[model samples]
Target: MDPLYTTTDDPNDSMENISSNFTDSYNNQFVQPVWQVVVWAIAYCSIVIVSVVGNIVVIWIILAHKRMRTVTNYFLVNLAFAEASMAAFNTVINFVYSVHNEWYFGLGYCRFHNFFPIAAVFASIYSMTAIALDRYMAIIHPLQQRLSSAETKLVIGVIWVLALLLAFPQYFYSTTAELPGRIVCYIDWPEYKIWDFKLTYQICVTVLIYILPLVIMGVAYLVVGLSLWASEIPGDCTDRYREQLTAKRKVVKMMIVVVCTFALCWLPYHVYFLLHMFHPDLLEERFIQQVYLAIMWLAMSSTMYNPMIYCLLNDRFRAGFKQAFYWCPFVPEGSYKSLELKTTRYLQTQISMYRVSRMDTTVSTVLPFGTPDDTTEPAREEEPGCLRHTAVDLSPNGSTRDTHSKTTPPPSPTTTWTSED
Candidate 1:
């Protein structure tokens, strides 16, 4: 007489009574038509294919390229790992079970099917939450020390540990039962006199996996958006500073799109499950099977959208994707190579320029002599027993002119510029 199972043709017969009437062939009353099943199968299969491939590629892009291994990308790796794992392990299985209303995979898989999705979802959203906090720290408090690579890895580990703990109850309570004509897998929560344990657990899972993280990210992004958009650029800000600000804004925008996509995809799923818990009669409606399929498909579709979003909104990710698929017929030759690789001479020149600029600031600030006056005198290069000298002139237009004079050639510079996410 469990609410999960529908009554047999005989309205008065209980599940126990119905089970005795069938031995071999199960009457699947919820079965859809052949065409509807085929369409649903195609939809679900597409989610699996795109999600697994897209997320795996995202993981590879982050982990394979040393240049791509930042704190944000590390969190992205975790997010991709969770999404790919869920899509590969759970999506199609969930489709088959939901559509057929039978559990063919036995008790162990049933437990895993229920348990791992929760854990994966937990890891996925909280990875996003971690990214939001990281972004907030970076933009709102630029001087604060950001998470190092080691610290980021440790945080990812802690996220998984917490996810497993949160999902453990689902695994423990999951069991398979031989109902009227079919074996079914479900969570068998023990009843309590004071409250409905199942409903309470569902509510907790919904909050932890969906509501709470969304709230945190919402607040973080709201502040970040205001700061980035509402503030005016300083009059003296350099082009490099302006470029950096634009880059930060792009990153925040990309993440907001990703977060919104995730929220929209999962909102209906949480609503559906919550309603099912409270109004069990809704499950008995004739159209409910199709409703469940549509909702589940939308939720699972979230797994595939992030890689697409990154490709669209991020230049580096787009370049990485191009690099990954460079073998394609349409990709221009040598395009991918330039995305991450720079010439040694180009890097050296950039480093030298950066050093010379820094040296100019230092020499102007700490020298014993006052600021240099306009003069056509050529400064002499370094001689043994004398300090380096350079000539600087202030033009009428307020630009400082520097003579091409150096006491010593800048040492061969080794640093290279790296683009961040």
Candidate 2:
């Protein structure tokens, strides 16, 4: 019999064949018909290309554009980085292993091969959780201050550290064992209670990576959605208020799509691993290899869809993506200007004055309020002891008073939101 076409009827021979001729036997048996390999190769390559380009564009938008640098966007940047890394490092390696049925990259990459995907996934899911919490804070308590850039940086730093710690177990346990002429990458648990250890580890990973984050994000988005939908806009109906409301709703929608897509894409992969852990016999099934490949590709495909979702659902992100890939003819010229997020202006004005008591005794005055450039109308007298302040106008050159104040004036505040980019 030809070595390539040899068949083992005995279970012992089959086991020996798997150990010794894993690459040759499995390739000859499974990847029959060259067209199947070509199709799968094309599909996996597309996933990698789309994932890398889309995630890199997101990172570029957040980093290059000053206005896009918000706390939520910062968390998104972290997520994009994780996805890009996973696609670049894990996807092709997985495809090769699936087709070849052996580890050929030697031992060093085998450790990383086991380690990186888990860590990247941990970081990605936690980043979503952080974004959910950020949105909850922003919407639920509008008066409360949002996380500053520095604070967000610190949080992202902690997330990566935690991800590394969580994935360290894989690196510790994984090894490439020589099986006849080939090497197979697998976890080498100790002789005692290896099943128990694997079960516990997998359970812990599933909970932290999937269940906990899912719960937090679900509750957060639900509350945020209800709050935004139920709450009423204050004051008269102005274009600015309309824009703000529209932007807020769009952001909520984008985030909901992101979280839901992530959950759906990863659900099958996690469930399969959990089932495999409990039933080792399933691994011997003829179709088990196909099932594993399908679930894994589904999981990795998750990274590619978020960028598409963002581009489709969000005007700001879409515009940013277009700007990054301006050469793409689909992007219309001069549209990004209007799509840029509205800049928020901040100014501080200090006042020093004396107030009169009932007996006309002087008292220190401490009145503070923020007014935008457009709302600096004459103050309507409401009651006694009421003081009205003038709104400062921000301009191209410098901040100038509107000259509409009737009372004693305070020190002029310099505006930082310049007209030019």
Winner by TM-score: 1
Estimate the overall C-alpha local distance difference test score of candidate 2: 0.67
Model 2 misplacement above 4 A: 1-28, 191-195, 231-237, 345-421
Q: In candidate 1, what residue range of length 10 has the lowest lDDT sum?
A: 369-378
- Per-model CA lDDT versus the true structure: 0.70, 0.67
Candidate 1, residues 141-252, lDDT tens digits: the string is 7545667778989999999999999899889977777865577776667777898777777889999999999999999999999988887865554343455566667888
lDDT tens digits by residue: candidate 2, 5-115: 112111213345645545554444555357867777888888899999999999887787775666777888999999999999989888877766667887788779888
Task: Give TM per candidate.
Answer: 0.78, 0.77
- At residue 150, give the lDDT of candidate 2: 88
Residue 336 error, candidate 2, Å: 3.3
TM-score for candidate 2: 0.77
